[model samples]
Target chain A: MYIIGELINGMYRNVREALAERDASAIKTLARRQVEAGADALDVNCGPLSKDPVQDMRWLVEAIQSEVAVPLCLDSTKQAVIEEGLKACRGKAIINSTTADTDKLDAYLALALKHRASLIALTVDKKGVPQDKERRLELAAFILERAAGAGLDAAELYLDPVLLPVNVAQNQLEDILRVIGDFKLLTTPAVKSVVGLSNISQGSKNRSIINRTFLVMAQAAGLEAAILDPLDQELMRSLITGALILNKAIYCDSYIEAYLKSKLKS
Target chain B: MAEELKMITTWSQAVCEMRLGAGRQEGGSRKVTLTVGGEETLPFLFKEGALPHTPLIAVEIFDVPQDDEPEALRRDLRGISKDPVTWAKAMVEDIGADLVCVKLAGIHPDGANTSAGQAVNLVTKILGAVDRPLIVLGCGEAGRDNEVLPLVSEATKGERLLFGDAVQENYKTLTAACIADGHNIIAESPIDVNIAKQLNILISDLGMPLDRIIINPTIGALGYGLEYAYSIMERARNAALSGDRMLAMPFICFVGQESWRAKEAKVPASESPAWGDQRERGIMWEVVTAMSCLQAGADILTMRHPQAIKIVKSEIQELMKKAQS
Candidate 1:
């Protein structure tokens, strides 16, 4: 699985204070730990606490990249903040993300093409998260059609079926799983799929158990990547176990050890 | 509504291209050099990536006459098996091999126990007899191999030859020799991708260039753990294409060595009447092994039988045609 470490975002208390105090070392520490935890990439977000998200995003990118070589996923609803973060990112940066809206997709596609970066496009539109598989597939089709019409390779595109809190969006969770599998048929060469794992268990009791269950089930439903806390030992173990069960990894008596070592391959 | 169906593709980062055998001005004296690696995707996955080069075949020739206990195994090379020079000559002039492999089996203490001088002489004779690029392999013993393989490597300096089976336990001497001699090295691992990659990482950490490395993931003949070997090579090759430099060198499989050793290939037809003629059965045995290795992304197949080599060459031609021009 392509794991993106989701710890550097300002939504967290430590990251929020780090952003306020302009702590580069704090950000670097998180970056190193996540990378050490086997994150293929790091997600950087200024969150709502930043007065100037563009400045904060740039600092996060440079601070993390200054110490580590892994790619950074620039997380922001604003395309300009993502673009500014891209300018600061030394290597390839993932633009996370855009919805099925045409204008939003056109702008993000242009930025992705100009920067030669991969994109995470959510299966959402002006109508918000779809409640059924057909609607989700339709929005996914729109993203693929527009991305392709814009000359982006499907491989370069990663489609996300928006994951909402299980406490509030229980009815739509099944549709999310179904859409993840059917999304492959929406385009040729199959657009990759990723999910923000924490979104599943937000505001729910037994969050770790809920999150792990959703991750494994989503993986079985064909999720190729995920935005999650690699520091969460149980979650990462479940992800590794799910991958083994899916035959993505060759079996060995010491497969967990092997996977841990090779997961560091970026 | 009717619509046209099209298969799109994903762009995989290409594997490194490794050049073997430096000619006169460059260093070696081979009439024709060979190159491998440089695949952008899994083997023959045309829609996903480009297969830049078809796998090359290097027929194996030993320095001293090997045991030919089974009369059926030596029937094809009865006269040629007696001398390294004659066998190598027939390998290039008659078999149409892409390259030649000289095994210093005689240098092993268990056998002819030939000295370094004798091993060097045999190597010189084969090099003189065949102008194709050469791959020189040592015996199975690491300690003994460490002793003589270096001398042969030094004697054949500037030939840009490919040296064999550098394992984790015995790579330092050979890697240094390869670097100093201006030749390539093949890092061999048991049928395990992790060990295969770890060996490459160790070799590359020696500060020698990675392009001079080839991977021998080890071979198991058909019906003899072939799938295990195939998966190891495939996974390692996939990792290489996926941008892991340590796992990315073109793979070299000892196809002929492993295939011809199988009981199915050595036993007589009368022993198993259900099986076909022993000669044809043995030939098919090697062909199937070589062909399977080709499918698993072997960049160099060191084969034995001339007829098996011919069939494999033709099959590779047909398989490669499926790639986009």
Candidate 2:
């Protein structure tokens, strides 16, 4: 599974203050912690609250790259901010988001092609987030068509079905779960699927439990990647256990320990 | 539109190479050395990965004469079997066996009851008889093998001899001796992956690096549960390639011993007219067992019959050439 550590963002208190005071150490610490917790990449967002997102994106990219060698998920709603973040990335990066709207999809598709970076496209279009599996598939078709038109293969595309808070959209969870497997069949080599792991329990009382439960269930539904808080010990352990259960990795007596040791190295 | 069908090239993380025998400068008195393992993919899969070293064959020559031995085994070595040294020389000079496996059956208490000192003397004479690498095997008895094999291991201290029959109960003694004597070990398990892994874990716990240890997940001849043996070996190889360090070493199969034990190899034509000639049937039994094991990733095959060994050796040559490109 591909894990994008969702910790270094302006929405978080520490990251917010770090960006305000230009404290690179704070960003570095968060970057190091997530990578140590088995994050294949770190999702960095300037948040909607940033007065100058392009500059903040550049600074966040440089700070995280300076501290850790992992790839950065250049996350932003603005095309310019994502472009600026891409410029500062030293290695392969993931463009955090593009929705299914024609103009938005076209711009991100061009950037993805030029930078040769993977893209994570949300199922919601300009009309708004889909509430049913059919609408989700419709948006997915548009995004995948636009991506392929620009010569981006299935491997370079990650389709997210736009997770919503479980307390409000309880029925949508099943809808998303039902379509996760179908997402893989949409292309020849199989397009990758990811979910914003914490979105399911955004306001729930049992946040950690809900997140861990949904992550494993999503995995069984062919969700091969996630934007999650890697530092959540229970959630990370659950991910490893789920992988073993899926027969994705060979099991040994010391499998968890072995997994962590290899994670630390990578 | 015509879609071109292309093959996929997958790779294993690592393939460890095990060297047997030491020359003058390295340690042994042999004129040449033998190497096995170091294959990156499934055996004989040229499209997938590498076949670094061709599988080596060592002829099994026993220390004592077998008056009641199977007729097929006794046919060629009948007279030479009187002495270990003569039989060993014949295997290397006549049959061109890569190495001579000296099975010290005479030392087993259940049979000849030969002393450990006598076993050492036989090994010394056999080493002098041939310039090829020698593998010293123990009788199946655990207590007796543990006792005699270590002494034999110590006697051939610098030859880097690959000694075996190191079962779960008897591995510590042999591993410790190999650690001290600068030789190698063959850890034998009873055709089970768990026991095979446990045996490897035990040997590794004794500070014997895996590269110095070859695994013998016991075999079953064709029509004699050979599939069970194949399945166990395939799983071990897969686990090893996926980073199970304990199982990443080379594998050795006792083809001659297991194949000859089957009734079909020696079943009388009078009893079953369709069974065919005893000699040809027996040789084919060993050949098929070796070939099936090779496909399942055996790095070394030890056989008793000269004709079977010759066939397997030439097959290994052709296989290696076909896989190189």
The top-ranked prediction according to TM-score is: 2
Count clashing pairs, candidate 2.
1
Best by DockQ: 2
Q: Residue A200 CA error for candidate 1 (Å)?
A: 6.3
The list of candidate 2 runs beyond 4 A from truth reads A3-92, A229-237, A249-266, B1-15, B19-31, B63-68, B102-137, B140-189, B194-215, B235-249, B268-274
Collision count for each candidate, in order = 1, 1
Docking class of 1: incorrect
lDDT of each residue in A103-202, candidate 1, tens digit only: 9999999999989899999988888888888988888888888888999888888999889999998999998998888988877667899999999898
RMSD to native for every prediction?
Answer: 6.0, 4.7
How accurate locally, in lDDT, is each candidate? 0.85, 0.86
**What TM value does the first chain of each candidate achieve?**
0.97, 0.98
Model 1, span B1-325: residue lDDT tens: 2232265445445777888777888867887877898888877777666788988999888877777635555878889888878888887788788888888888788888888888877888788878878899888788888888889889989988899879878899999998888889988888888777777767766866878988889889998889999988878776666545667678898888888889998888788888879998888898999889888888999988888888888888887887755
The TM-scores, one per candidate, come to: 0.71, 0.81
Give the Cα-based TM-score of candidate 1 against the true structure.
0.71
lDDT of 1 at A214: 93
